[model samples]
Target: MPDRWDCVRENTEWVCKSTVVANTKEAIIILTAKEIGPEDSLAAYESHLKTPRMVPDAQGRPQKSVIKSVVSRKIAQHTWLDGLQLGSEIPSYYTRYLATVKSRLAILVTFSAHQRYFTKYSGDFFKAVNSLRIVANSDLLNPSATSSLELGGSEQIGPGQVPGFGSPLQVPDLDTLPSEPSGAPRNQQLLFLIGIIIAVAGIFIFLKRK
Candidate 1:
């Protein structure tokens, strides 16, 4: 965890929040792990990524969820999703989902930030995500073989040395963010906080299907 960031672990998920930003505009990152079964294959993940999605807005109205980008790396599949309304707290949000399977362990790293601040803090978010490593048991056969997901390659940061909290995660400019009807400053932090919660929940829900 980075300085000024607090994390809580529940079963297979870890949710971390940055406190450097105001409470109204915080940033969040979630890491989740699952035990993969024989049926869970990388091809399934790719298909899911290519599928279109419809998300419910704050008013309970359905809206199209857009996949901004998708990348299939040797060891990991990365997807960027945007234009999803996560309820009143987060009228609009952005998410980067990095999925990989290593040693029969399926891992998903999710980073969420207010659409307006995502760009600013993305560096730290990705650094933390890429720093995660799974050490396969040496006794297992085919020790030389690696997982299909290539989650490594970034400069690693040591324990208790997570990326700093001073940056944003590549959010759009404030002007581009939706404002309240009354013209009051929106509570952007809630968007990030809620995004983390929904993301963790969604991960478990989806993993159960694998």
Candidate 2:
């Protein structure tokens, strides 16, 4: 894989595929992983952005703006993700997320194309980040060919991917899901007749014995 500093992580690789990438408002999105540092919070990294940074802009020189960040949440020592909004008026946003799972604080940083774009796409981004699971014991640094590649997680199939029991899986009744087969006639009527025949035969046997 290409070792682009802005897109790849040291321990794990991410698939940040999207259908949106353009010069338009918040059109480009990028994700990169770095070693979790003492600054586990998003605001913790604002000092780094104090210096002016520039990006390629076909229109003109890259806009220089004071980078300001907002911490979405910080749970003492549990899980937290902070958002950064760069640029003025029409802005750009970045999401910095960290989770302390079993003494390991995995870090993920995102660069949003635009603040407006980030807000529009934040829902999916939050969903993706919140669902992250890391296997601290497994060989995440290097996996065999048979090893399944997924975002660091413990969920076998994810939030709504189990049989009859995911966020998206709700069965109100037997009719909601296919048991034996779909559109197949049930044998309840035949079974009821058979049950009645057995009951009548048992009654006759009891009277004969009496």
Candidate 3:
């Protein structure tokens, strides 16, 4: 076996394979020890092996054993795999389990990307995922302060301005007006009335004389 060969054992059967290849970027490798029994003849042929080598005979012919093991050795090379140590009372397949979870999450997030089904809640969920990513990389809860709540726009009002539900501005009280009079000056009003009366009186006198 090559130095890069990862070993997996299941049910007394061991197979050596590479967990991953840097140049090829392949993550899985399948190896066949040998072929046995008529049931696995096709698999044996596919593996380019003639007869089963590791296992012994059953009642009559050798029983074909099908064993599957993950490529753990090469998987350990990945940084993500370092958290998933095998056989330490913790789950032995944490790496594979997390990969499955991430895959499912990606699919769900992708499906939610369609516009028709994406509501405000969906947007919130997407934002939450983004926040998680930011939290993983940074110390701040909010990565951008400008992206906070909007202020002073068409959708918002100035400070101390209460929005009216049914009217543009609240109606003012009748007594709330200033005590000072707002009409013309008192002398100007008297002069205007006097001018009107004199004009009428002059017209009447002229008619009587005529």
TM-score of 1: 0.56
Displacement of residue 162 (Cα, Å) in model 3 is: 66
Q: Could you tell me the lDDT of residue 164 within candidate 2? A: 18
Cα distance off (Å), candidate 1, residue 61: 0.7
Across 34-95, the per-residue lDDT of candidate 1 in tens digits comes to 44545345665555555545544545566654555556653223332212222112335555
Report how far residue 209 has shifted in candidate 1, in Å: 21
| TM-scores of all candidate predictions against the true structure | 0.56, 0.38, 0.15
Candidate 1 C-alpha RMSD relative to the actual structure: 13.2
Please write out the lDDT profile of model 2 over residues 68-149, one tens digit for every residue.
Answer: 5434554323344443434321213232323232222234434333333454555444444443343232212221112221
Give all candidates' CA lDDT scores.
0.46, 0.32, 0.21
For model 3, the run of ten residues with the poorest summed lDDT: 103-112
Ranking the candidates on TM-score from highest down gives 1, 2, 3
| Candidate 1 segments exceeding 4 Å error | 74-91, 138-210
Q: Output the better candidate (1/3) by TM-score.
A: 1
Residue 56, model 2: lDDT of: 23
Worst 10 residues of 2 by lDDT: 173-182
lDDT of candidate 3 over 1-210, digit per residue (tens): 233435453321222233343321112111111111232222222232222122222222333322122221222122110011111111111011111011001100010111111231232222222222100111111212111111111222111111211112122212111121222212222223223333333343345445
